[model samples]
Target: MKLHPTSDFRGLPPAEDALVRYLCAHAEALLNAAALLGDRPAVRRTARLFEELAETRQPLTRRQHAGIRDLHRLLSLEGVDDPDSLEAACFAEIDPASPVVEEICLLTDGLASRLAALRQAEGQPFGMDLSAAA
Candidate 1:
């Protein structure tokens, strides 16, 4: 499937809006893997994302579930018939970047950086081109 169909979310500022979109992408991907391959590994990853979202204590709705299903259907076209092999290959592809724990650290870093920027913007004076920096 198309990993990112468009960067439309760029119109949003980098904070809660942007970070939530990015995390949703990650969560959707994991759920997609589970739907396509019946992969428990993907389910676990998706559950982690769910937990993170839950930390905010926001209520989940039907749309999110639909999003996961749609992504799974689209990505499953290649016929990832064997989940074990799929997970193994996925891990192998990322192994060179570091172990699993460090990989998660990097992902969390991206989310935190975007979220922090948004929070900073909230405290900044509004309606100005403060994004200008040297």
Candidate 2:
């Protein structure tokens, strides 16, 4: 017997929810990066789990490709662990984005503060898709 999608998926404040929250919290900045690079008008909703395909655990999606690139650029400019190397690496565009998120997080509280400010200035609200449909 298959469970209802929502029933199968756990709500927020759980283990999976932790990761979801982490992504959601940062998504405001990440969304700007995505909107700038991707050619689509991003709606306030459906930014994270925009599609069922994203529910799968893959390295990164094609849509997310530009976002990851732009984020690395932004994070680097923000001096995310020495912007020079980050910039040089981004021009190459060969590295994956999953690893970069934590690196940016570790840069400093200042980077986090700046990211929050940028997101606020850009007027990005809370992330829409906080969790997948189980």
Candidate 3:
């Protein structure tokens, strides 16, 4: 998929705008790395999902979040030894000092936290049962 410049997100609520921007940046970084790594097909799938969510201003479902997490895990586990070196090679096309990888990690963590908060706000207890305390 061709990388398109993301539209301005300032119109969204602050939190939503931040989340969308992060996701869009994360997707672009992934696309860049995927192109260099020749893993475009798999990464493109996950990246597109993120892009779509960002564009729609919709919160991710737990399943969708899990899917992205799983894809990330798989990517990370592709080679056991010297993962950083492998990643550096994959991202060689982009400047090594570029903050894409760091930003991607931060965004992923933030997205997970945001998703959990949303779930809690929706009254969905992830692993705790409040019924027993009642």
Candidate 4:
């Protein structure tokens, strides 16, 4: 995905705009790392998912956010001997100091919090109630 400037965020509400920009940047970072990692299966999977999400050019649904988070956690750098070194190498080519891991963490955390807030605003609890089941 082509990296979009913050100005392109027009039309989206402030919060959604920020989220979209962050996700785009995250996608670009992961995709660049995937490109340098060659044909590894995990990298390929992550690249595919990021590409799909980037092409959407819209805010991610909760399920899509969860899927990407899982892929990032489980497959983004799987089997890499030293992910920091790999990230450094990739970032050197794309962005010299773009901290992929931290960005991903912040983005996922923010999204999760936003979802929780939305649920709360709608009068829904954050999680299931075991007492009801019992």
Candidate 5:
């Protein structure tokens, strides 16, 4: 079911909610990049997913989140390993007159880093802290 956009942020504390919105903005940035360079079928498909999510105001399911991660991985595989290569690779075949490619690459890399940190932070197994027991 689709969630209200506000509902998506409802239970989160202010900081966490802001993080969610920040991440959503990053996803939108990725979507913009996908639109600009989505000549490939896979990239086009991923863009469609991002579009749908944006329109529906839905929280990502595990599968959808995985798809975002996969898209980021694919972009990295496209030789975006560093700033110089990212500029060169992401701007391939584009007019040098347009200046957004570098920004897109920076956004992509930033999103990937944030996503990685979120994943790592969430990866810890759940358990009670019993160290205070006496």
Candidate 6:
């Protein structure tokens, strides 16, 4: 799959825009991984989530924002000790010589880095508690 550049999220607050972009990119990566895994159901579900996020301008609640962070962490293949998880399994099947997998990995890494930078600039700690707002 060809990786597209991030979309310009106009008419959204900076934070909301960042969150939406992050979710969209994350979902895109999941969709690619699902394709590689031949999991049609995952592809459909992730595609729906990506479309919903791309079209919505609604502000994310604290919990939803935290969910993004958690999901990003779950999808990250770096430093994970679990061998049976989806991320690990997908990564295990990836060929180091394959450009598609490499592109997906790079895109995912870039998105995660961008999200971390956005959180830092907003004075938010990584994985900050959202329950406090409940």
Rank order (by TM-score, best first): 6, 5, 3, 4, 1, 2
lDDT of each prediction vs. the true structure? 0.45, 0.38, 0.51, 0.49, 0.51, 0.57
Number of the top lDDT candidate: 6
Q: Model 5, range 31-93, lDDT digits (tens) per residue?
A: 566655544554566665555444433344555556656566555545444556533455465
The sequence of per-residue lDDT tens digits that candidate 1 reaches over residues 51-116 is: 544343232233433333333332332233455566444544444455543535555456445435
Give each model a TM-score.
0.33, 0.27, 0.43, 0.39, 0.52, 0.60
Better of 2 and 3 by lDDT: 3
Q: Considering only N, C-alpha and C atoms within 3 Å, which residue pairs clash in candidate 4?
A: none
Specify the poorest-scoring 10-residue window by lDDT in model 4: 125-134
What is the C-alpha lDDT profile of model 6 across 1-134, one tens digit per residue? 22233665676667567657665655656667555543454466555556555555555555555554444554465424566655566556778798876766766676577666666656779665433321
Worst 10 residues of 6 by lDDT: 71-80
Better of 1 and 6 by lDDT: 6
TM-score of 1: 0.33
Residue 40 in model 3: lDDT: 56
Please provide, for model 4 over 1-134, each residue's C-alpha lDDT reduced to its tens digit, 9 standing for 90 to 100: 44443436455445445545555656655554455543355477665554555455455455455545445444234434565665444434544255754654554565555545544544568762212210
- Sort the predicted structures by lDDT, highest score first: 6, 5, 3, 4, 1, 2
Lowest-sum lDDT 10-residue window in model 2: 1-10
The better candidate by lDDT, 4 or 6, is 6
Candidate 2 per-residue lDDT over residues 37-69, each given as its tens digit: 232433232263433223534333334434432
Report the Cα lDDT for candidate 6.
Answer: 0.57
In terms of lDDT, the poorest run of 10 residues in model 1 is 125-134
Largest TM-score belongs to which candidate? Answer: 6
Local error of candidate 1 at 62, Å? 16
For model 2, the superposed segments whose C-alpha errors exceed 4 Å read 1-13, 41-134
